[model samples]
Target: MGRRGEHSKSEIECMALEAAEAIIEGEGFDALSARKVASAIGYTVGSLYFVFRNLDELIQRINGRTLDQLYAGLIEALSDCRHPQQCIYALGGGYLAFAARHPHRWRMIFEQQPRDDNLSIEIYQEKMDRLYELMEIQLKALAACPEEEVFIATRALWSGLQGVASMTIGRKPDREEEQWAQKLSRHLIGHYLAGLGTTQFNSRVNQSVGRLIDCPK
Candidate 1:
């Protein structure tokens, strides 16, 4: 963010981006506007237009900041874990805790889907991939499955975990929720990894019976 001997355009843009994120955190996206942002940072609305063409561009800046923070948290969580099991647990806990602390930021990351030009969906999915890569590497050490399957399963597991996390943040907080949240989330993550260790579901169903009424034999 430093340039030669003075403040660069990049530095100004970074300030605007951070300001926008703060605005979103203070009030929902509906409350976000060029004028509001400018007022918050003691800049005129025209100044914001210099860095961003419109509100959408500002939103993109917010998304980039969100991803940057998410990646940092993930790296820090996995920094000390030597075993894959510990790494996986840290990833899950870190993700949930992040959502809990920054509910608005979490939604800002996923609410509006990013454009698929230079930054394809794969780019966003890459974040999930990095997290799952740890699990897959560990799985390969003990399992005999194809890499593609592992990737797909890991994605599904993350989707499930993200679902619970986002829901917990969006829904009103409940004191009774304390009874099941930790156990439920942990069970979801454990089963996801444990699912990779096996291939059979051991379903006990009457195949002979169908979804039909017995009108006539």
Candidate 2:
């Protein structure tokens, strides 16, 4: 075990977070505890308290890191896709793959309710918005809809993907299950995009008809 002063405060904090993640990933979030994390890092529980205000803060930090990782995975999924629609599919595939790979961490992101501090809430919202922004960009490009429509579509598509994952992904999802989830995601995206295109087309036609009716004749 390392002495308390051997590692700087920041290093201790990083070590604790990594240890906590490993515990959660291996044994699930319910298995996480300060003492376990501390022991894993060759430090005392008091050492963890020194760097984190409480266990809640530590969990929040983990959630933040998970979000950043998820965002990066989604970005990587977009690399080979040139079209906006293709990018959206890639995003859905990436999301499901991440959830399947890190089932416990992914579940913790939604299931764990962090303490409601303003700073924490702000930070969480910013991280969530970054993910939503990825979908919004693709939706706007593909749908060519109003900003309000694009926003709604972004959330709607994500909600659908989340639902698909929740229903299909398991604690240790197999390749077959993962493939099934991907299939559902593609179906959902295909139909949703088709409906969006139809809606926009009908709205444009209605506006044109209204304009013609009101013109001087």
- Which candidate wins on TM-score? 2
* Model 2 lDDT per residue over 116-136, tens place: 676479558999999999999
Q: How far does residue 2 in candidate 1 sit from its true spot (Å)?
A: 23
TM-score of candidate 2 against the unseen true structure: 0.91
Residue-level lDDT of model 1, residues 1-217, one tens digit each, is 1122344557667777777788777776667788877776666787777777677667766776677677688778878887666677777777776666676777877785556444535346566456567556655543444666666666676787778776666633344442245456788877765554323221113334322111111
Lowest summed-lDDT stretch of 10 residues in model 1?
Answer: 208-217
Error of 2 at 130 (Å): 0.6
Best by lDDT: 2
Off by over 4 Å in 2: 117-120, 203-217
Error in Å for residue 199 of model 1: 2.9
Score candidate 2 by lDDT.
0.86
- Pairs that collide in candidate 2 are none
